[model samples]
Target: MLDDYGLIRVAEREAAYRYAVVAPQCPADLMWPDIRQSTLSILDAVIKKHAIDKGRVFLTGFSMGGNGVWDLAAKTNGIFAAAAPIAGWYNKDEAVHLTSIPIWAFHCEEDDVVPITETESMVQALTDHKGSPRFTRYQGFGHQHSVMYETYSNPALYTWFERNRIDS
Candidate 1:
């Protein structure tokens, strides 16, 4: 992600840096192997075509996508540098699969659509598994998409992702 360079292509220390935000929204479900594989294929294609940095690859999502983030992180643990799932939900048992990777999860305490408990349970489970995951619990958002506005606007989040990049 490199934290919204405004453009996907930019120059950093005279070296050209390229990044892409590929959102696979089809089927709106991340559990489907076809969709997950297809998304991976798409990323692979983009990386090979554009020479994207493998170590900087990050995963994120909102709502259902947030839930997908947890699932995908578990299934593709070593593949992503880090993950930021907003208002996502997943089975607590799956926490074991995600213990090794860095995660930053967000959720509104007042969320009516997907209760904050969903995120809490996951975060708690991850911690129980000895995984130190970051959690940002906001109040008054109440499941509204405004949570995204507040989150994406923060520069620190992007920098956090950069710091967590995998070393190749």
Candidate 2:
């Protein structure tokens, strides 16, 4: 699925490793904790098995996965160096937890599956909390796979990742 989704290409171009965790199928009310644990476990497994630069770890995802990026980075404390949540949304109250993390959010103005306002509200919440998050809003694209393709393919995202990290 990662190859089909072009994550392999993203990893190769960034010279970074990307791990995708598959969560057990469940309803939304019961999903967040499991997803959070799965993400942390993957991080632990990768750090244990590879030469990972602990400080440069970043999180990104599209659609539902993008929602996961937002939730995980906000709740997981210092684990992620930065987060890029594409076409995703989260509780605006949780924005307080994200104030310290670097975020680069993306959404399409004509998104059909997930409304662009979801991302707009998040970015706004972050801003209200005095967080400086970069946002990329595209035109003529609905909330489809092409958005992720364009986002992951852009070299600027990787360069931005390089510029942000958890200060040890």
Candidate 3:
């Protein structure tokens, strides 16, 4: 779910952490399986190649990639150390599965393509299920506001990822 940024944002964090960026060729509705497969394959490869801390495996994405983060994080348990989905959406059915995972979601108030309510609803569903997830909402931003630019521009997001880990 690389969306359109290619390797721009993900590459910036490479100096601090090992990560794999996935570029999805499929359309949005049919992207789930490919995203899941690519992510799992990357995880397997990273574990085998690097003598790294398994608990520190983090996930983040922009736009459609962000949506994939929410979907995958909900589908799998204890696979990611933490998740940060920028302008991502999810269905209520995926709420319960995300209870144990630490999530930090971001969205803009004026995004016309995907309404801010998408992220809000997911957060609200998780909250109703007694799951607390950190959510950041921008006041005056649209679809092109926060995903790649702000998330990368701010160090706090990276620090948030570093602070969280899956309960192993």
Candidate 4:
């Protein structure tokens, strides 16, 4: 499930880690649901076939796919250990259900497509429920620029994923 501008490929294979990228087909209104379903199916297969640490499974996405990350995390419940949704939106009603996972969300203060308020509202909803989610806002960047450059340039995002694991 690759979203517009999303490229999912095998990034690395090593003794201790495997990295797979998932990019969703965008124009979000038309493709999001399909992307979600396919992604969930793939996740199920990955869980069955691989010796996934389960505790370390991470989901990260930008733009429309970022929205997918939020949706998947909320819908799948305990399946993902952590999530990073960059410049995305999640319904406040649905977002309240995300109780157990750690989320590190990113957004640009200047974003116009998906307003920063959406992220703020989500954080507020999560906090209202006593959930902990780390949020970062890039001051001058817009929505697209914030996610694209930040994700590629910073190695810390990957490290963040590696640091957490699902609680069994």
| Shift of residue 113 alpha carbon in model 2, Å | 0.5
49-69 per-residue lDDT for model 4 (tens digits): 876666777888777777888
Q: Rank the candidates by TM-score, best first.
A: 2, 1, 3, 4
Q: Each candidate: what lDDT? A: 0.79, 0.81, 0.76, 0.74
Lowest summed-lDDT stretch of 10 residues in model 3? 17-26
Tens digit of per-residue lDDT, candidate 1, span 64-83: 77877887898895689999
* Per-model TM-score on C-alpha atoms: 0.85, 0.87, 0.83, 0.80
Better of 1 and 3 by lDDT: 1
**133, model 1: CA deviation in Å?**
0.3
RMSD of 3: 3.1
Question: What C-alpha lDDT, on a 0 to 100 scale, does residue 107 get in candidate 1?
Answer: 91
The collision pairs in model 3 are: none
Worst 10 contiguous positions by lDDT, candidate 1: 5-14
User: Candidate 3's residue-wise lDDT over 1-168, tens digit each?
Assistant: 344353455465457644554344436457765668776776678776875567877777777878888888888877788888888787877889988888888888888888889999999999999998999988776888455587766778778877887555
Off by over 4 Å in 3: 1-7, 13-29
